[model samples]
Target chain A: MMSARKIIETIDIRKIYGMGEVSVAALDGVSIDIEEGEFVAIMGPSGSGKSTLMHILGCLSRPTSGQYLLDGEDVSRLNKVELAAIRNRKLGFIFQSYNLLTRTTALRNVTLPMVYDRTKEFTPEESDEKASRILEHVGLGERAHHQPHELSGGQQQRVAIARALVNDPVLLIADEPTGNLDSQSGEEIMTLLHRLHQEGATIVMVTHDSEISAHTQRTIHLLDGRVETVVKNGKKKPGKEKVEK
Target chain B: MKPIEAIRIAWEAIAKNKIRSFLTMLGIIIGVAAVIIMVGISAGTEAAIQEQITSLGSNLVFVQSSFTRGRPGQGPQSGGLVFDDSTAIQDEVEGVTAVVVEQYSSETVRVGDVTLEEVEILGTTTGFPSVRDIDIAEGRYFYDLEIERKQKVAVLGSSLAKELFNNESPIGKYITVGSTKLTVIGVLKEKGMVGNTDYDSRVYLPISVVFQKFTPSFFARIMGDSVRMIYVELDEDANLDSVITQIELLLAKRHGVSLEEADFTVTTQQDIIETQESTTAAFRSLLAWVAGVSLIVGGIGIMNIMLVSVTERTREIGIRQAVGATPNDIRIQFLTEALLLSIVGGLIGIVLGVGGAYIFSAFSGMRTVIMVHSILLAFGSAAIVGAFFGYYPANQAAQLDPIDALRYE
Candidate 1:
């Protein structure tokens, strides 16, 4: 563990809701470390603060107290614009609802992240080319022009995954990425995540399913705003499919 | 984000809600159209007045013979300018080019069993043609020789000729005025209207004949050869103020009185035109303000609908923020939508406004002039209205918190 390069570090972080007498602490006195290129799953009950921790790690919220360091830089005090910049350039997010813009073609939806990255200059044609390539990588090259409603549930999630990977982000944060999918689609998404993990991608997924937890390299379980246990699982078989790059 | 990308996003949103977008722009459309039409009418009134004045005469200085209110009983010793004063001004004034005396009488005119009663018969010297810019459509205007010879000849305005002759040539024809038969030698072309004077519907005769035929019946013969008004034309390079002062002093000296007691009012055409223009300008601004109120109301409508749109798209805004859009970016996107709506509406309003002005002129028989400044003002105001009214709603959208907006029901 000492030889591994740390990518995310939290020192007794806490997030409190409300103020004075009627306050509730969503995350309290929690500390964890995630190393580079590691796939980890966060598990907890409904009110156990796993989602709060994910919000903090993804730079969507600032901790109420203590420190959060990402890639060896303190991010707890960053401003909204700075946080947005980090999110655009370094973090990718996938939501349970597969939040792709309605009425937009798959290729255009995937190109949106690059359009918001102000630091990089991309012409419309260049963004279009890059988006199409990413779409092809996700096996949706034929569905590039299809709108969100035209695609099936599994196909829409695949488009969302392509959007998440368009910016080549450093960390992929997924919250119940397969929650709305059919069982067969869910297995395909899990297999896709496992495949990316073996290719040296850093991933953090939040889910309560133990069956999903078995696919990750390590798991962190939370109980009542604090870390309960950390476990290593190697039960799932490796995916034999190779990516075409 | 780049501005073009923001515009594209705004266009997409507007295209998705085509009916709502058109409804939002309708207010601006009506406002802009009203503004243009008002301006057109105002400008046309000014042009019509200027044309009417110029048609009466060029550089005309009018000396009106207002009878003095003498002390009751004293026989009112000829307290008005007589026809000799017209010759005096023509001879003595330095910049004076010509002077013509005008007197009028209403009489029934008869030509071949068709009679027009109470028709105006104007009297003037042959200077009428060059000084008044009136053209002869048929034969030549009667000149100095005709007037000096006291010839029983008359020139009919083209419309008068049409009424009496029914399209038959009026030149070399005879028309009787009050049982005094006269030959129509020439006809004036269509000169339209000047103030209440319809130049085309009137008849013209020499001052000698008008005085002999009408002035002998004057009240108790107290006014002998006294003309009602005198029109003086000046050289093109002459200063109007100087000419007016010279005539005032000359008339005072000739009548054996001081300038104030001269019993005549001398005025330049410029003074009359200025008075007309000032009145028209005030009316124009009043109409413009009334029209501008509609534009402001339109702006308020835009703001109202924009607020509703922001509320409806709260989740969409939340998703954009989560995907890394800044507050400024959100503001620009919504602002772009509003600006596009107003600009497009303004353009449509311009076309409608100009067309409306044409229709008004055609139906009402009044001229309408569309000035370029009015169009630009209407367009520029619409853009400002969109941007100004759009600010609050766009700010509301930008200030939204990602967490609350994303979780909103």
Candidate 2:
């Protein structure tokens, strides 16, 4: 029997920058498959080609040579407009910088994906209601009317997370979601991600910190445009458990 | 995105930068105002010209003989109207009001010790004043009996009276035109200048006497004996074309020429007025073109400012694109902003330009005529300019790469 699940399968994805003598390969034959309801972290150092891969997965950029299948449909060959539709419907994004429109309220930011999707017409009241509900889910119900600038770094990141989740997309791809926050704010954001994962959200986050990777159930380590290793069910060792406590 | 949301976003964006938006709209304001003001002034001048022409007289016709066969510019050769044609016009034309034959000659006139140099002496019958709509200020004009009996009587223009007689009542006095002496029977009421020619510096006399007394030898040069030009007045109810055709046929037979070779030019006052109106309309259109060019320059200014705005708002565009705004939305937002600016500016300009035109008419003593059609044209052109000039920058804003835009500072 076929399973009704959202899955991303990338086959030998290769992305290159520039050409001729100045050729630089950003992604070199990297392939990974993320199953439904999985919380996976892509960990890599600077210049590890992880962001390029993330950009391709998020539908922001097309891979130079690859087949990216979202739920078994080949999205790699789709046009820009079609890809935009897929991004609107199937993928949600969280950025480290909490990319909210500076002049708009938190509710307006959350309603943006629905606006792009061209779904059921949402009046201002309807958009506000949905945004408030999503904000409530993210523990930010009280800050619905506030602008990004008015919120703390952790709160702003949560707002970004709420905006991403408002569309109820199949995959949440976060690019360095906690990179710009303080350690405590980062921990709170990670806890929120963990709670979202437990609520059956499929998350794929990119981070450079190994400590942050420990929170996720699985970690994919990338080095020099290649996946180095994949660790599944990364529980703490008996000797390291005492130190973590 | 919905159009309402797009409009709201555009409005909000413009509202956020109120000073910039207003400054950008200033170009459209000045352009619309210039077009309206220029058109208004031209219309006013045309109205003034029409008024002046109408004041001269309506349905009054002038016939001047063309010297070179049918060609108009061949000096004044005679084979034209005779004194008998004036009588024939009154007798033959059904709507003929009055007929006055005139022969003009320049001569010096003297009264007492004062001499007026180079004064125009008009030779016509006593019915000239009534036919030409001139009135007497003092004494009385010559009677019909005086004109039939070849009496040497003159009616002095107001300026001529003032120059020769000063403040004294010169009724029953005599003035000498060249070697011919004439009695000053009346002083004409002051008639101001017409088309910059001083009408109030002329004298009038009987046509029979002027021809018999002065320049009797001049008639030997032309075929047939006649007055130089015939001024005819038609009844208000008469069809001008019928009269003109009848007069043309009669004059052709009288002159003993074929229909094509009839030496006289007959025209009605309506012809002169129409010609003046068309000429003024041409001038008005030329002025409108100049004003329209300025509007184009103003539109260019709008385009330039919009381009700058697109550059300045690159990041905002990127943010919108990132969040799901299509390129079409970006284009519409900027275009709508431009249209709104131009529409508001155009309305303001119309008010100001119309008000300015009225003020000019009052202060400068010129007739101002503003037509609704011209106002509509000015406003419509302003909107078109807004759309045409606003399109490129809006398209550029729409075509910006979302990735590059998001990274824009």
Candidate 3:
């Protein structure tokens, strides 16, 4: 079977640092396409350009030269303000550290993206209701009022996930979503990602762990600022590993 | 981001660090309070001085001998003001209503068993009561006939009357001054202290009686009928400058001197008030400037604390940026926090300053007039300072790179 539409299409994207004397290429001659309903992983060792690719895809940083198409819209040459608007309306991000604001309740953390929603798609009260409902979907309804310090690592990551999905973004970009969690919490998070994938949500995750990559439909492997292989996993399996607490 | 959301976020950040925020606001509080209190006191003193000078009398002019201030033992010179000048101003000047001339002396007085030392005795004409705004409390003042006939008549000031004869009336009582005994016909009303002069402690007598009884100085014998000062009162509709010019010209002719070499100086009540007001205005501005410096220091304190907060919350800012907050939004958030701190501090200072003024006035017995403009100025400057000093740090926070900020420790 073939997907009807491509959610992300990049063409030979490169990110260079320092213009004079000695220059460095963080991303070099790498291009990939992600289908509308696919769960994909980008895996690489340190300095392999996986992080730079993630930053460019997440719209947190612009590539030095490339054409980045998000949902059929070219966004590579957009300015900072336009990029921020695109990020707000179409993309959601999950960091390795579960960067939930400290001293803020889980519900407020979930509602934060909507605060910067310039379109004003929802009133403040509607935003609260929508955030509350999403919190319930992520099994964090009971911990909605708890601050980040009051929640465990897995719960904080769940809050972050709920926040990412609150605006109903077209793509979810998760970078090492389970890196900070224990083995059981990591497995639970993988199961949640699988469920979301089964519900026809597009996900792009960046991680170095092969076991975590096994859970996705496809994996893009990077070595030395370029993609080395694109592996299509045959089927999903219940892979379990006893990670250190 | 919406401004309301930005303000809410700013408020949350400020509330999280309540102690630090309050400490930062302390500078603004003291600065505003100092400004209000200083301006209030200066304004009160100015008002009090105006009231005292106006109380002397309305539409009044004082003509004094140029040499009267310095030449003490010399008494009256040839060019000194004589009693005849008062008559000429009253007759020749068109708008003049009353003229009173006075010569002062200090003498011991005795009434029955009570003896008061160094009582101020004023030898004045009949129009002294109207010209000086003094009224009789119990009995009448001496008439022009009494001065012309050289009658031994005296009027005791209210306080002197009270001192000489406790609760009893001093009307018709006899008081001995030097070797002569004069009958007290009237007691002057109680007028409170103005500057250093105590109107109620004085004794008023007919000028003729003083000239006949008191021994003449060597210069007084040569300059016959020379009085100390002449007070002229004009009608309500009179032009003060024109009347002053008329009296100046008439006096210059009588003293047989050129207009530029006139012996007497003429000054109206308005001139004295203007001079005193300009001095106080300068004093008031100086106090305001000193207070303004403290406000600027307070603004610097806000900038310092805001910079520290920006540095401390770098990661939070990065997260916000990742979540789609624009640089403009970040700038507005921090700017709102700074403005809130100063505005709240300014409001508190206003309350404390007004209350402090009243408390000070009660304890120290000094008048303090809390002007509305002073409060507005303090508050306005506080807001401006917050915005002015807050811009740099807010821009610094806005210029932070999200990638580096997220990775910061």
lDDT of 3 by residue, B266-293 (tens): 9888888999999999999999999999
Candidate 3: deviation at residue A34, Å?
1.5
CAPRI category for model 1: medium
Output the lDDT of residue A79, model 1.
86
Q: Candidate 2 recovers what fraction of true contacts?
A: 0.26
lDDT of 1 by residue, A183-239 (tens): 898888877776777766688999998878767768999999999999987533234
Residue A107's lDDT in candidate 3: 96
Query: What lDDT score goes with residue B360 in model 2?
Result: 83
Position B222, candidate 3: lDDT: 58
Model 1: per-residue lDDT, tens digit, B4-52?
8998998998889899988898899988999999999989989999888
lDDT of 3 by residue, A42-97 (tens): 99999999999999998989999989999999999998888888888888888889
Query: What TM-score does candidate 1 reach?
Result: 0.87
Please give the distance, in angstroms, between residue B146's alpha carbon in candidate 3 and its true position after superposition.
Answer: 4.5
Chain B TM-score, candidates in order: 0.86, 0.80, 0.87
Off by over 4 Å in 2: A1-4, A17-24, A71-73, A105-107, A132-159, A182-195, A232-245, B51-58, B64-96, B101-230, B235-265
For each candidate, the DockQ is 0.54, 0.33, 0.70
RMSD from true fold, candidate 2? 6.0
Native contacts recovered, each model: 0.40, 0.26, 0.64
Question: How many pairs of residues in model 3 come into backbone collision?
Answer: 0
